[model samples]
Target: MPIVSLPVIWIIFIDIIAWTFFHLFISAICMRLPLAFFLKDRLLFQVFSWEKSGELWQRLFRVKTWKGFLIDGTIFLKKGYSKKGLHGTRLNDLKIFAAETKRAELTHWLSILPAPLFFLWNPLWAGWVMILYAFLFNLPIIIVQRYNRGRIAAITA
Candidate 1:
């Protein structure tokens, strides 16, 4: 049950504002974290055996066909690393790319964690919509990051 009642328009407005804060705040925190934190592959960032080094995403999602259309969110931040494309063709550049993918993945994952907060003010169905919105907005990006990181691991191997 909602802790507070709000008109639908007010809820919509609040959702927009809240999501904006969540995205930027989470991104800023991730960005400020030491780069070393992302350099090593963490458990969550690992491409498990089932992923077949990211080919699963290629087969299931055809990521190549649509990934180009997704925005490079770093463009919005003042001092963020760009993940729009590879920085260069060197081994070091590729390693950096892989690390940045981990950072990106973590940011999206953290962004999804606050979905339940909407339940504090939303009706049952609307609260579920917020959860849906979280996944819908963030999951594809997370998939792309994982896919690219797996591909990078294959290349660097």
Candidate 2:
């Protein structure tokens, strides 16, 4: 590559590294943070809090506005979907589409990574790394949701 190209390559490399680190750091934070205090343990929050759910509903379904935004932001950023408005009508369809799309994307991304990197890099050690990252990151949130649900059920009963 030309000297001029070197800078561009360096920039791309830096960006990728930054992106990877950001994902890992955010995943760590999400996994570690407590969620029970915030969402009140609703079933919606519990089921959709993880990466798989987010990918399933948000990215693939391309659900309008809130659904898409929330799913993408949370899975990729370690946050939650908006609970503001009514989640009516096409909610189920949107979720299915998102899930399908997420699966495809995950497969594509995983396939592209170097297999040897799985052994060399802790983060990229295997495809399951992503799932582990998601599970741990979403655990705190799930716990919070479970607490909330118990409170709601008790109140209702």
Candidate 3:
């Protein structure tokens, strides 16, 4: 019997389902509770903080204008997507962005799964490819939320 190979694209497709499943699951929980309990509070959130000046790594992600085009998560993000159009003068808008950023960060953590889970089905290439696909899909939204929140935080300060 010949061993059939699974394509990387298939791994990516599974990545989408895993990503969205966890996305919806976590989002629903967050909607119901203010738990705000990330698995590792400081380690996960702070590691991705990039920088205030942002030259080292944050520069790699899209600018505000360019980012709006990617998925326009400003519109699609569940909680505060609606708040984007609100004036910065509104302190509540800052709160909304903060809440939404926490939700988006939850998805980033969710993206880290599936790779390990995929190892059960595909121990070699598929597992690694799924990991890459997960990061590629999730990181930008993470960056966008972080960047936008930093700006919003400044305004509300």
Give each model a TM-score. 0.96, 0.27, 0.65
TM-score of 1: 0.96
Tell me the spans in candidate 2 whose CA falls farther than 4 Å from its real position.
1-6, 41-157
Summarize candidate 3's per-residue lDDT along 77-110 as a digit string, tens digits.
4553443444555676456656666666665666
- Over all chains combined, what TM-score does candidate 2 have? 0.27
Poorly placed runs, candidate 3 (over 4 Å) = 1-19, 35-50, 53-58, 72-84
Clash pairs detected, candidate 1? none
Q: What is the lDDT of residue 133 in candidate 3?
A: 74
Compare the candidates by lDDT and give the number of the best one.
Answer: 1
Q: Residues 4-47, candidate 2: write the lDDT tens digits.
A: 22344564464457447655554444434444332243334344
Least well predicted 10-residue stretch by lDDT in candidate 2: 99-108
Better of 1 and 2 by lDDT: 1
- Scored by CA lDDT, what does every candidate get? 0.91, 0.38, 0.57
| Per-residue lDDT over 33-61 for candidate 1, one digit per residue giving the tens place of the 0 to 100 score | 88888888689888888888889999999
lDDT, residue 37, candidate 2: 32
RMSD of each: 1.0, 14.7, 5.0
